[model samples]
Target: MTHQESLYGKTPDQLAALCGELGMPRFAARQIARWLYVRHTEDPLRMTDIAAAHRQRLAEWFSPALSAPERVTESADGTKKYLFRTLEGHYVESAYIPDGERATLCVSSQAGCRMGCRFCATGRQGLQQSLTAAEILNQAVSLPERDKLTNLVFMGMGEPLDNTDEVLRALEIITAEWGFGWSPTRITLSTAGVVPELRRFLDATKVHLAVSLHNPFHEERMEIMPVERAWPIAEVAAILREYDFTHQRRVSFEYIVMSGLNDSPRHIRELTRLLNGIKCRINLIRFHRIPDSPYFSPGDEAMVRFRDALTARGIQTTIRASRGEDIQAACGLLSTRLKGGI
Candidate 1:
């Protein structure tokens, strides 16, 4: 059975090409874009502006192909974890977090992660497959609160930079004028510093960036995140220094503080030395304990003290509030729970 291509993630240009190939009027492309994005309508028949004779053919050749979430777990803090099944039958999770006036959707870029970060559950499952741009965009387009979503963070499941081509394609559709037209500032891509791809991303888009720099020292970071050995945090910082993040686009270092591990003043000193002269903020994240994990989250007082130490050094820092801990929806907790079985 050959699967029909999904039109939900296609940009206006691609749709225009499809129209040209199908012998349909070029104007039909914009109509389809309006139906898919502005009107949020997926059914070709419901695209009333399109010619009646072409609607059936359009539906036959392409499908909206938005897969509904297989399961939804809501947390007490108004955070919802949505498990979506990829076309390949593997599962990935996206978290929708609502904080007062702000609502952010954390999206996944792949089925399982290949980065192999020790603290990450997704990394534990290993790499299954990469999601197409359609699969990635479907998570947002099919959301119940899609209209209310204020921000999108590529911080779930996999290293987005590893899937650079599809991730960039999705970003283009998300922010293009004929697509969703959302501001690039509202989207942030987080990566464990795949240097070349990170450089490519920085050159291509102005979306905010968050680099996983859990430890300042190379050897210490390599202990948990193996990516450190390939592209050292120092080199990542150097690459970032070449760009100008002092404007609207922002860059931040994600430091997941582990108890008695990287919460000392020495780490702060090294961090200050490493990130010196870079116009960026540091986000201190509390480590969520996984099963049989060797690390533990630091106490609130300890976190506050670390934040104060960095702030006193003229660096802007914030202790990110941990959410959905009960449902395992926080950082590094998203996984399929299936191993070799499927």
Candidate 2:
């Protein structure tokens, strides 16, 4: 049996086109978008505002495209990792972090990752498949805390720019007025620098950009992040310099400080020189050790020292507070290896 196409991720324009093809009234497109996004309902029967005949037509050809997570593991620090089985039977993970008055949902853009960043668990799984836009949006739409979320991050399990088309569609649905109506500033996308797609992403969306610049030196970065060989971090920074980030929209670098790896004074000096013209902040992340991994987080004092040294160089830097490490949901630790049960 063939599955019905999903309606949940369609933008207003796409929905309008769909409605036209379905022989429904044009206004029905807006109603369906409101029901799918604003109301967060997947069942056409729940769309009370749409006419019965039109709703039936919608139900016949399209589904709401939402899926509840199969399992959840919560950390003592109020971080939760949700395991979701994708439509293709592959599994992915999403991390929910709740801070005072601000809750961020980090959603995955692909089932597994193609970017084999040495430190990232997701990349080790190899590429399963890029998620459809519906699957991407469902991470937020079907969340139990959907209503309470204040921010969204595309930093979960994949190189988002590698799955640029679907990721962009999901972003459009999240921020469009006829959809969730969220401000672009409320979202951030993390990438390990896919230069061509990065250019496309920067041109198309106003969401905050976070480049994974774990190291400043080219050869050294290539050792940890293979994307550097194809699209150098220096070139990524050069592309970023073309954009205006001194205003509301911001660009930040995610530097995972591993002991004896990337947390040296030379790295700091090179970082300062590499990011000289860009007005941006550096987010120093504590490395989380994965199974058999050689990388280790330098303790708090070293992290603080590194942050201070960068700040002393006139670049704003802050250490990202480690959360959900106990549950393996923190940065560089997300994977679906245990998704079969967990």
Candidate 3:
């Protein structure tokens, strides 16, 4: 028997096409969108707007296509890490962080990462599988605090640009009028400058962008992030400079401040020179040390000095707070240990 199609994460246009195949009217797509996203219904039978016969047909051939987090761990600081199992039976993690009135969810785009950044734990698992649009959206759709989430960040488990298509689809459903209808400004997709796809992401969506620039110098960055060899950080900066981010659309650089590695005056001067013309902020994140990792977190004084130095150079810089550290929810700590045959 053929497997039924999942209705979750499909765009309105895609749903319209599905409706055509199901012998339903085009308007049925919007109705389904309203039920699936607006109403957050997980069962076809509960869609009261659809006729009984149509609902029956839906139950037979279409599924609501949502998966709840298999495991959740809450940190002492109120950050929560949700472990989700993908269709491929591999696992990924999503982190929900609450800060007063603002809350953000860090969602994954792939089961595991392939970028192999030295400082990242997820990369150790290599590539298990690329997650579907439904899987990417499921993290947010199935969230207990979905209503309280003010922002979403694609900075969890994988290189978003590497899994560009599915990430793009999920983004469309997130910001589209017929879907969740979230503002593009509230979403940020971080990448280690996967140049070609990064350019496509800039052209395709108005959502904010964050470049992972741990080191300002070329050689040093390549040591940690192999992607730098393919798409140099300078080239990424050049491409970003071409885009207009003067208004609501913002672009920021994520700099994980490693104690003595990239927190020096020389790196700051080079960073200022590299991002000279680009209108973006620098978010200095403290490196969360992983097992067998050579990198160490910068002291609070060093982090503050780094932030102050960048600010003095006319770049808006802020030290991002470390959250969920006790639960291994900080940067570069998300992994299912899938490579360990778990």
Q: Tell me the whole-model lDDT of each prediction, alpha carbons only.
A: 0.90, 0.90, 0.90
**Tens digit per residue, CA lDDT, model 1, 249-278:** 999999999998898999999999999989
- Give the count of colliding residue pairs in each prediction: 0, 0, 0
Give each model a TM-score.
0.95, 0.96, 0.96
Model 1 TM: 0.95
- Residue 269 in model 3: shift from native, Å? 1.5
Model 1 / residue 195 / CA error / Å: 0.9
lDDT for residue 268 in candidate 1, whole number 0-100: 93
The most accurate candidate by TM-score is: 2
Clashing pairs in 2: none
Task: Write model 2 residue lDDT over 72-160, tens digit each, in one string.
Answer: 99999999999888887888999999999999999999988989999999989888879999999888877899899999999999889
Model 3, which residues run further than 4 Å from truth? 1-4, 338-340
1-342 per-residue lDDT for model 3 (tens digits)? 134468887888988997888888889989998988888785789888888888888788875568899989999999999998877678889999999999999999987788999999898878888988889999998888888999999999999999999999999989988888999999999998998898899999999999999998999999999998899999999998899999999999999988889988999899999999999999999898889998899789888988999999999999898899999999889999853364
